[model samples]
Target: MGVDFDWVILGILAAFIAYSLLTKAVDRSLLTLPIIFMGVGYLVSDPLRAAAPPEILSEGKRLLAEFTLVLVLFADASHVRFSQLKQNWQLPGRMLLIGLPLSLIFGTLAVYLISPEGGIAMALLTAALLSPTDAALGQAVVSSPDVPERLSETINVESGLNDGLVLPVVLLGAILASAGVSDANTDGLAIAALIQIVLGPLAGIAVGWSVARLLDLAQTRQLIAESAEGVVFVATAFAAYVFAEVIGGNGFIAAFVGGMVFGNTYRHHIRFIREFMDGAGQLLTMTSFLVFGALLLPDGIEHATASAVIIAVLFLTVVRMAAIWLSLLGTGLKIKEKLFLGWFGPRGLASILFTLIIMDEYVFANADELLACVSMTVAFSILAHGLSSTPLARRIGKT
Candidate 1:
């Protein structure tokens, strides 16, 4: 495993320019940045892998993926305005509350049925890991003028919040999968999980509230420069994650909770956070996909099984669609609207990050099969959702 720094750097630059130049065309068509970057990485994986240090390839990619997720989680959470959501909260609320759990249940059952040998833990781990949706994968649908405001906002909010909501279950599944491999004590794991859940939010609140206050006072006194706000935004996210981790709590949860607090409390400065996400956040996300193609996807495909592909198909289609459809049953949305919402739940960045976490931090007896299933699902999503988003959104808008 080699890290081709020059190729990676040069490719990123070229892809950035190319994508930027044709941004409108790509948005209007069935193409997305993730698709292009991932395809490029896949096409040149051999050369990229051949030219790098093995250690850096392994650890560096994992860290890059993790930090990307942390930033995404925080930024996404910070964008939510609770006050504005008061009017249209029911749709996303139902999806997060009802649909998310149902997707996990359906996905778990499907994985378990397909690979009974992997056991309930493995099935649960796979299900939980794939539960979160990445709206960026289908940005055209979410950002399209053709899409109704209610529909687009619902999708955006659901995607923004679901990843953080599912992080605990993902972590629990990881622990259980690890325990299955190593005879870890169930009671101790239970205790640790409880503490993690409780303490993570506490740390987040502390960091977020404190930072919000500091920023507020600074702004009031005209002490902090406007240009420095972006730096503060990112630093706050890292502070929350690291603070939680140092205290044995969940870093991801802390980052999200902290972001929620910071965003809501310091609502006036939210623009800076958005700007950071638009630039740094987008770069990190695209880099993750490229790294996935060059590194993770190859190994996942190599370990792919017939059962893995089947599970991936089921997760993307039946599990997700059914969950969304059922959750929106009483919302008075038409059949077409429900189906449209159901189909766009593309699994991308969050799934990739969760899979990378499982690969880096835990040992699973069924690691290869598990990873292959996740990779295939994300790859399928990039194509299926990315291509369908523009056309479907336009069709829905017309209706």
Candidate 2:
């Protein structure tokens, strides 16, 4: 049966609607839907005697992953409350300052020792890619009213900010790995990276604040319609991204900063915008997982050596848990709170995006190994953390 473009679109839409309805009746495991859809994609793509060709699926997977990440980064940042962040600054402060760097160091060392084939540069790149936690991966913990609000907020804030935080490290590492660290242009590239990091958020704040003020003025003058508010929110996010990039800033950082500033400045407008984007973000996220299943998983698994797989598993489990434990040291959170936060630092969307960005750079001669490490780690996290998030949160809640 030949399928037209409209038919294909309609089929996907119907499948998603049916999947959504089914999820209502099931236990709603985090990895469950992703695993299911991935299986579906795999089965469809597999011929009796041969695998589906890469050319058939690679572009679609890449585009879906990128779009999902853009929406997810914006939505996650938009949910942050600057006031709340200020009041409960200790947890996030320690996590970013101490926990993050420690995690990167530990992860790099772990990768280095475990994957001797992947040298220090590849090891460090893998570490940077996996260091940032995926907030959406552990939604049950962060979103739960039962979880200690401080702990929950800290994780949420950390996840929202860290992806942007790690961008400079990743970029610097890429440049160093691609061009020897001692190259003459390294200093210039470092300066450029610093500018991107600093100016990205600054541009975002300016554009976001201006847009928020304009929207408020329009609302006061009764010049804006309720129906058009959603469009305005998206336009503001896109403008932040475009303007930041035009000036050599990180567009992802701008999206996040734009969302944060907009969230703070237009508190009343956020609920509507967030609700609209939340649905869209979830859909994009699901599509990302499906693509992961169909494209990255099989290829990553096939390319992954024993050492790479071992490192990926260890990073998701021991390395992450250890970093969380140490990071929470001076915060005075209860052991239970600390442990829950530690184990739940699941890597997800951000890792995937970082992998894509690095893949584009063609930095590592061992790009295949690097991509394999990243893909395996992220895939494992989607299963391991997703399965455990709900039960673990409930257990901690009881304590």
Candidate 1: tens digits of C-alpha lDDT, residues 1-399: 556579766876797788878887976666788898788778767877777778978888889977888889889998888888787889999999999999999999999988999899889999998889999998989989999998899899999999999999998888888888854455587788888898999999999989998999999999999999999988999999999989988889999999888888884647888888788787787788888788878988999989989998998889999999999998999999998888889999999998888678877889999889988999989989888888898899999
Name the best candidate (by TM-score). Answer: 1
Best by lDDT: 1
lDDT of model 2, residue 268 = 59
Which segments of model 1 are wrong by more than 4 Å? 1-8, 182-187
TM-score result, candidate 1? 0.96
Using all chains and alpha carbons, the TM-scores for the candidates as numbered come to 0.96, 0.88
Across 1-399, the per-residue lDDT of candidate 2 in tens digits comes to 443545444655676788878875544555555555655544443331133345545555666655665566666677778787778888887888888888899998998888766567767878998898987677777877668777788888889888877777787677666664333355476677788888899889988899988988888889988988878877888888888989989777888888888878874546766667667656776676666665566668788888778888888878887888898887778888887877877887788777775675444667778778887888788777777877887777788
Tell how far residue 52 is off in model 2, in angstroms.
Answer: 8.9
